[model samples]
Each structure stands twice: as C-alpha cells, then as structure tokens.
Target: MASTSSFDIVSDFDRQEMVNTVDQALREIKSRYDLKDTKSTLELQENAILVNTDSEFALEAIHTILRTKAAKRNLSQKIFDYGKVESASGSRLRQEITLKQGISQDLAKKISKLVRDEFKKVQASIQGDVVRVSSKSKDDLQNVMQRLKQEDFPLALQFTNYR
Candidate 1:
C-alpha cells in the first residue's frame, strides 16, 4: 500500500518585495530629470499608494514607474486598481493606486484544477483559497512539487500539512 501525506499549496504575497520595489521606484522618480523639479510626491499607505503630480504627463510617468516596479517584483499587473484623480493643492492631481492581496477566487480554483490535472495519480481538493494535494508515496508528493515549480504559478506558492 502507498503511504499517504497531505499538503496545501498557497501563495503568500511578499510584502517586503513590494515595499522594496516602491522604494526603488521612488528614488528613481526623485532623480529623474523632468520630475526632479516638479511638485510631485509619491506616498505608500497600507491599502494603496498616493501619487500626486503637477501634470498628466508626470502622472503617466509615475504610473509607468509603478508598473515597472510591480513587474520586477513578480506581482501581477492586474492588481493595480486606478482610482479617480482628485485635484490636490496648487492645481496638482492626486491619483490613488490600490493594491490587492490574496489570490482571487478564480485563481484559487484554477490552481486547484491545475494541481489535480498535473498530478493525475494524486488527489487534490480546494480548501477555501488553497489547494490540498494528497498522495500515497513520498516520491509522488515530491514529484508533484517539482512539477508545480516547473509550471511557475503567478503567486509564490507554499506547501504544508504533510502527513
């Protein structure tokens, strides 16, 4: 009989990476020639980022910087939800970029399906937002993990609950 163990596959968003990327982007914006003299500001908050610029062109530049940073950090570009631009002091426009954490419901289902499809010999079940895989043999479980890494899911997935 094959011995069985269970593990959960979850994506733990890397908050530190996001913060680091934001810091780097801020530095670049500060030193950039055109933005150096503008009355622009970038601020990070718990739920979103606030970017204020003197003109639309500067706002576009800031958006580009943010997108680049998000990509560099392996974050999905889909997470950025642009809020309405509000008029700030001195005719400046302030834009808020909302950051979303946690895998979406659809993504969770997709991941669960992927795990099951890839490891045909193993059984996979979706528990809330995580995928739990069970196999009788340790080798089979290891093989599944290897295959998952090869597939390269968007989120940073982790495995747990091995029994």
Candidate 2:
C-alpha cells in the first residue's frame, strides 16, 4: 500500500503584521496634511478594527491609507469585512471592520465538492475552518493545489502541513 500525502488549506493572517499595519496607518493619519486636524481614530480590537472619523471623506482617506499599509505588509485586503457606517455621538461616523481568519462552512463544502468532482484520486475533507486534501500521489496533491489557486475565492488561502 502506498503512503498517503496530504496538506491542509487555511485562511489566516499574521497578527503582528496587522498590528504593524495599524501603527503605520496611525502614523500617516497624524502626519498627513489633510488628516492632521481631522482627529480620526483607528483601534484594533480582538477580532475587528474600529474606525471613527468626523466625515465620510475622512473615513475614505483612512481606508485608503489602511489598504496601502496592509498591502505593504503583504497582507490581503480580502480579510477586511467592513460593516455599515453608523452615526456616533457628536455627529461622528463609526465603522467596524471584522477580520476574517477562517473559512466558512459553505466555502469549505464548496472546495471539498470541487476537489472530489475534479480529481478522482484525491479526497478532500472539511475539518472545521480548514480542508484537508489527501492522495497517494504527491503529484496529484500538487495538481489539486494548483487548481485551487487558479480558482478565484473571496478569501485568501494558504497551504500548510504537507506530509
């Protein structure tokens, strides 16, 4: 019997990188001419980011800066699931941007189905927020990874624990 090869697919981001990006964004907000007097604020919570600004224009500027910083840190913008802007006290606007750290059950099922349908020799099983793909041939596993990369998914994925 041939030994099976497998890998796990996961969607996660580095917390330190996120912290660095937020710090950079804060610095830019303080230094930028247009933003210096706006008193805009950005706070990183356990699983979300709180952005508060006085106006819609400032909010947009903050978002642009945040995106730029995140990209510079090699972080995917897809992780940011922004909520609706709400009015706060003193006419301020607040927006909560949730961080996506895991794959949804629906997406995991879709991925499993795609793998089972496309590669007869490969088997994919959902394990919570991750999908484990196993096959007797390493080449088949590589092919599965390539196919998954080619397909556009709303969230960013990473492959790990290959054995």
Candidate 3:
C-alpha cells in the first residue's frame, strides 16, 4: 500500500513585508514635493491600512505608492481589499485597505470543487482557511498544482507542506 502525498493551499501574506512597504510609502510621501506639505497620513494597523489625504488625487497617489512598494517587496496586490474612500472632517479623505491573510469559506469551497472536478485522482478538502489536497501519486498532485496555477483566483494562493 502506498501513502498519500498531500499539500495545503493557503492565501496569506507576510506581515513584516507589509509593514516595511508601508514604512517605505510613508517615507516617500514625506519626501515627495507635492505630498510634503500636505497633511497626509499613512498607518498600518493589525488587519488594515489607513490612509488620510486632502484630495482624491492625493488619495490615488498614496494608493499608487503603497502598491508600488508592495510590489517591490514581492507582495501580491490582490492581498489588499481596498475600501471606498470617504470624506472626513475638514475636506479630508480617508480609506481603509484590509489585508487578506486567509482563504474565505466561499473561495475554499470553490477551490475544492475545482480540484475535485478537474483531477479525479486527487482529493481536496477544506480545513478552515486552508484546502488540503492529497493524491496517491505525486505526479497527480503536481498536475493539480499546475492546473490551479492556471486558474486566476481573486486572492493570491500559496502551496505549502508538500510531502
């Protein structure tokens, strides 16, 4: 009898990388000519990033900076679920960007269904925020991973614990 090969699929990000990106963005905002004098603020919370600026253009600029910094750190842009910008007191605009760290139940189910439908030799089961996939043949597991890579999901997926 052969043991099964298994791996876990997770949607996660590096918190330290995110913090470093935010710090870089803040530095850039302070040094930039247009943003230097503005009362703009950028902060990273436990689960969200907060941005405060004076105008729509400034808000966009801040977002662009954050995205660029994140990309530089090899972080996926999909990890950020940006909220709608709202007007704050005194003509200020505020936006909250939530960091995605785990697979949602809906997405996990979708992934499991896709794996089951496409790869008959593999078994996929949702375990909380992760999806575990197992197969008798390692090649089948590799094939499943390849197929999943070809499909574009809303959030970024990472494969781990392959054994």
lDDT of 3 by residue, 1-163 (tens): 9999999999999889998999999999999999987789998999999999999988889989999999999999999999999999998999999998899999999999999998898999999999999999999999999999999999999999999
| Residues 1-163, model 2: lDDT tens digits | 9999999999999999999999999999999999998899999999999999999999999999999999999999999999999999999999999999999999999999999999999999999999999999999999999999999999999999999
TM-score of each: 0.68, 0.97, 0.97
> Which regions of candidate 2 fall more than 4 Å away from where they truly are?
none
lDDT by residue (1-163, candidate 1, tens digit) is: 6567878877655678778878988898999999988767788888688998999999999899988987988876756779999899888899998876566678777766876777777888777777788887777788888888787555556677777
Output the lDDT of residue 135, model 2.
98
lDDT of 1: 0.80
lDDT of each: 0.80, 0.96, 0.94
Q: Over all chains combined, what TM-score does candidate 2 have?
A: 0.97
Q: List the residue pairs that clash in candidate 1.
A: 3-136
Q: Which sections of candidate 3 miss by over 4 Å?
A: none
The collision pairs in model 3 are none
Q: Deviation in angstroms for 13 in model 2? A: 0.5
Candidate 3's TM-score reads: 0.97
Q: Which model, 1 or 3, shows the larger TM-score?
A: 3
